[model samples]
Target chain A: MSKIIEIKKLRKVYGDGVELVALDDVDLTIEEGEVLSIVGPSGSGKSTLLNMIGLLDTPSNGEIWLKGQNISKASSKERARLRNKELGFIFQYHHLLPEFSAVENVMMPLLIAGVEKKEARHRAITLLEEVGLGDQLNNKPNQLSGGQNQRVAVARALAGHPSIVIGDEPTGNLDSKSSDMIYELLRKLNREMNQTFILVTHDMDMAEKTDRILRLVDGKIVCEMLRDGDKFVTRDLCKLDK
Target chain B: MLELFVAMKHIRTRKRQTVLAVGAVGLAVAIIIVFRSLMNGSFETFFDIFFELAPHVLVLPKEGEEYIYLYKTLIEFIWAIPGVAAVSPALSTTATLSFEDNVENVDMTGVVPAELNKVTSIGDKYMIEGDLYAIQSGRRVALGDKMIEKLEVQMGEDVVASFPDANTMNLVVAGVFRTGVEEWDQAAFVSLETAQEFLGDGDVITYINIQIEDPYQADEVAAEISALGYDAESWRTMFPQFEESLAFETFSNNLILVLVLLIASFGIANVMNMLVLEKTREVGMLMAMGTNQSQIRRIFLIESGILGLAGGIFGTAFGYLVSAYFNSLQYTVNAPTAPQPIVIKFLVDPFDLIAFSLLALILSMIAGVYPAHKASKLDPVVALRG
Candidate 1:
């Protein structure tokens, strides 16, 4: 599989005088059409790794190669352009602007990229329909249910056709039914469009469903697994002792 | 353009704040227009003092130069000049008109019947029980409107005017003349021959009041008159104090305008700054959406300019209404000289309106600069989080 996002010796540090590492010499490679999930408890750097993938936070010591460019040292304007045109983000909270209707909120990314308004609106409507939000396109975020708002956020993130969709707890605020719906939507989009997805979630049950899983503890990945065909396995599952 | 449109939406959403901003701009424009109008009034007053007090130019007796008695010779010579409008000679004297129980001081002007209407317009507006042309036609004296009240003399009744040269003469009350101005309304006008007769000078005159075809040409005519050995003075030369007063008014008005401009600019600055602070998150979103810094700044600039233009238009309309109402009101001064209120017309010149609009716009734009810059400099990451 071709790598869509590549990271090498990635390090993330917080605070000034005495720096604390959120990511310690981490290396990652996410391939096209891969549904990858980063699972960890609190303070396990799952969010920091997700942020680095989305280009929202910079690496302290590493190079991030996206598609074919070394984008780690890109100027702020260049980074903003790339973010607008090539990246989409979904946070733990469905951050749809309260003032805009679902379709308008979805159109934000397209409008920010200087797309014509009519075209952006057209695309946003189609995307809302794809996300089962056709009836709620004109409804504001406050008027929509938790599941509907999250669906709008998903539509917004996909509006610009970004190569990689990174979600930090996209279903963290939803009920179990809404979470199931979001997880199915993410998996279905990954299969239909063959787009890369990197999600950070605390729910291990949801994490176990992705094609690949990276479990971290104390800012370091302790185990990495890849589902083969339709089987779920760990390093011990394929051992002769099993 | 989208940023500006969104910014406009934001401004419109908060109507109360928008009104405050526009009101500040309106107040500034109002003050500017009023001061401009008052400045114009000051200019008109100055021009009047000059036109009424002095002719365009003055021809005077060169020091120790006696008029080689050129009234007849000079009149024929000056009337032939292309610029000379009309030339009249008058014998002037100080006298007191006394009735049965009243007496008042007067500058008695002995004017020729042909030149009486040409020298001053005060004679045209004022009339007592008798008529001016009737008085000038017969052997009658015209008393000023002020003298009529003081002397308590009736038309067709005779009064005794005693001249400084000791000639006491009995002249019938001809008419009363009033022009509002104290100087013209207080002076008595009579036939020049009658005045010369009263002053005991049959031919000698006090001075000549010359009117050129165009008051603008008065200077040239006066110069020529001086060459003929006579003294000529324009209205401005006569009353230097009124000119000084007009100049003082101009200076003070300019000072007030500067202060008001500063205050107006400050109001705009304060409002824009608050707007920037309040809308930081929106600004970040715009920046993240690929809006450049300069473009973001233009959004706020348009907002400020719109406010200024609207306020200016409102202020101008308001000023016109206020001035029109003020002008229509009868202002009673009850000045002992002219008892009735003189109608003052407040003229609104176009340049005054244009200047006021331009000044408010410039000040508002200046006020917008700092806040716009701050908004443009905002970082999308930090600002969005904030």
Candidate 2:
């Protein structure tokens, strides 16, 4: 498969006085239709790396080639356009607009992209149904349960049919059953639609279900594991560095 | 379009705050309307009453000269100028009137009765009894009712009139009238020929009274007349204090208008700021969904602008209703300078109401700018964390 994203030496520094390094010389690549996860302990920079690839934050230094465009230093406006057209994001919390109903929340990305309201609503209905929320179309975020809200958020993320979806602990706040349901739903979308997904999670069980996993520590990827049928092959980048 | 939709929802959901804001603007507009209505009503009533009988411009004898010789030519010259509706050349002199056991001092004016009728409302509006035209007959005069009272004389009676160093004349009082003005009610009117005879002066008049189509144009007409070497004065020049007071009132009105609008705009700003603070996470989510900074700003700006427009409309309607209610009262006040009590009416110009509403809308939009900018400049990462 052709590479959909390529990152070369990404670095993000935080604070003017303390200068904490959030992401340090991180390099990675993902192929089209790949389902991958980044897992680590607290303060491991998994969210920061997701934000960089999601175009929500600028890196201190990096060359990011997304679908053949070098967007590392892209202007904020251009980045925002790319975010709308090429990427989708699911946070740990639902992050659905409290003012909008389920269908309306799902229709937001399409609306932001200037889609016609009628067509956007139609597409949002199909996506919500795909996420098993067909009957909750008119319910607001407060009216839905935690898992249902996150499913609605997933429907919103997939509304624009973006090339890549990024999830920062997409099921972190859910119970085990709800988390498994969400993971299966995301996997089903990835396999059925051939869409790429990159998730950040603390749950090893969820991360192990992905096709590949990158383990991070102290702002660096220290290990990687690749799924092989029912097993996984591990690689230790820390030892390879020496 | 999305910004507008979101803005409408935001305002709709905050019903209490919106009502308070709209009520503030409404009260301000209502206060201004009531104040302006009463103020303009007073000025209008004063103009209607005073200009009813007074000349717009009066041409008196030139300095160092007692009378205008060949006044007929001057009268014709004044009538040809644009806006000059009527002109009456008259001679006025102090005279002593004696009628059997009563004697009184009277100011007597000589005129062509028809011309005097055209210049002032005395003949139609103020006359209480008898016809002014009766003075057209020789040796006949119209005496004020008050003067008639002082002389203990009635119409068809004879009164002896004498001026200092001039011949005494016995005139038949053919008419009696009252004008409600103390000075005019103590006066008498006779034919020009009789006045010339009584003064023993040949073909000369002391002053000319002019009525113009527009009283406000009096100054220009007076200027034109003064250029001909006569002493001319417009009513405005004769009453500088009135203009000064009106100017002061206008200044205070503008000041109050600005202050009231400023106070109302502050309310708008406060509501918008609170909205921005409360919607921080929502703003971040919008940004993450690829809504640009400018679009974020537009949402908040449109929200406040909607509030402003709503407030403006509310205020305009409220102001109109209050002014109309005040007008229905039909109050009256005594005017010490005027002959009778004046009725007060509230008058509002439709155009003024529209302009004030638009001004409120514009100011409210301005008030939205700061908060909208602050919302736009928010860091998406930090905001999303909240």
Candidate 3:
């Protein structure tokens, strides 16, 4: 498979006097049409990594290549364009604008991509229907349930038909049943659209269900798990220190 | 268009704040309008009094002479000038009038009643008791109301007049007139022929008062008339103090207007700043959604513009209504040149209304700049966390 994204020796440091490293010497690659999970404990830089890959933040020292284009030195405006046209993001909380309805929220990303209003609206309606929110097209975020709002957000993330979707704990705020539903929906969309998805999660069961899992501990990738037919195999590179 | 829509939505959601801001602008605009209108009306009143009581151009004799010779030829020559509507020849001198035991010194003026009527509206408009033309037939005199009261004389009563030329005569009072000006009321009037005969200044007159077609062209006409070897004084030259007062009034009015608009702008700025602070998170979300900084600033500017427009329209209408009510009420004001209390009336100029409204709109738009800049400069990362 062709590599969709590549990171080389990425380092993200916070604070001035006493530096705190969020991501240190991290190197990773994501292939096209791949379903992967990034599992980490709290403060393990899962969100920092997602933000870096999503073009939401700039790295202190690193080169990130998205579809063979180096974006680490890109201007903010160019980065924003790339984010709007080539990538999508879903947060733990549904960040849907309270003033806009579900369909309108779904239409936001397409609008940001400069799509005509009529066409954007049509595409947003189709996406909302696909997410089982066809009956709640006019409902605002506050009027909808938490799971429904999350589903609307998911529809919004895919509205621009991006090549890769980055989810920072997409189901973390939902109940167990809603989390399962969201995961299943994501998996189904991944298989149907043949699009790459990188999800960050702490749920072991959810991590086990993905095609591949990268375990991050203290800003370093310690293990990689891959599914082989009905069985899963794990490789732990950091275990040699024990 | 989207910016406008979003701005309108925000304003609608914050109804109380919007109303307060709009009301502040409205009240400021209304006060400015009222103040300017009243000042304009008062100045107009002062000018009207000056114009009605004095001729636009007064042709006087040379500096050393008391009266102009060949006055008839001079009158005909002045009448031939373009823009000269009418010219009335008059003679004035100081005299002492005695009726019973009351005695007072008064400035006596002699005029041709018919010619004077053409030069000034005073004869026709201000005659209270007797006919102004009655002075033409008999050796009769018209005593001003104040003069009559001081002399304690009745109509048709005979009074002794002692002139500066050692001429004394008993003249019958034909009329009592009041011009609402204390100085003018203290003067007495008689036939021009009578004054020339009694004062021993025959075929001569002190001055020829000239009215013009356009009062504003008085200075030019006065200059043209002065070419005839006589000193011509325009009303503006006669009363430059009034013009100075008008200038000061305008300056004061403009200062107040600027201060009022400044206060109103501060009100708008305060509201906009509060709104930006409240919507910090929303601003971040919009930026994250690919809204440019310029677009965000434009939204806030449009919001302030709408508020200004609304306030301007409402305030202008309210000001007009208030001024109209003031015009309906009758009040008396004392003026230095007026003998009686002058009626006060408020007048609104359309130019002032339009200018003030535009000023309010511009001030409000200016007030939006700082807050809008603050909103546009918000960091998406920090704002989203907010």
TM-score of model number 3: 0.82
* Per-residue lDDT over A102-150 for candidate 2, one digit per residue giving the tens place of the 0 to 100 score: 9999999998999988999999999999999999999999999999999
Order by DockQ, highest first: 2, 3, 1
Could you tell me the lDDT of residue B265 within candidate 2? Answer: 86
For model 2 chain B, give the 10-residue run with minimal summed lDDT: B334-343
lDDT by residue for model 3 (B328-359), tens: 88677876755567878789999978887888
Best by lDDT: 2
DockQ each candidate and list the results. Answer: 0.22, 0.67, 0.32
State the C-alpha lDDT per candidate: 0.73, 0.87, 0.84
* RMSD each, Å: 6.4, 3.8, 4.5
The numbered model that scores best in TM-score is: 2
Candidate 1: interface RMSD in Å? 3.2
- Candidate 3 lDDT over A119-177, as tens digits, reads 99999999989989999999989899999999998998898888898888899899999
Candidate 2: clashing pairs of residues: none
Whichever of 1 and 2 has more TM-score, that candidate is: 2
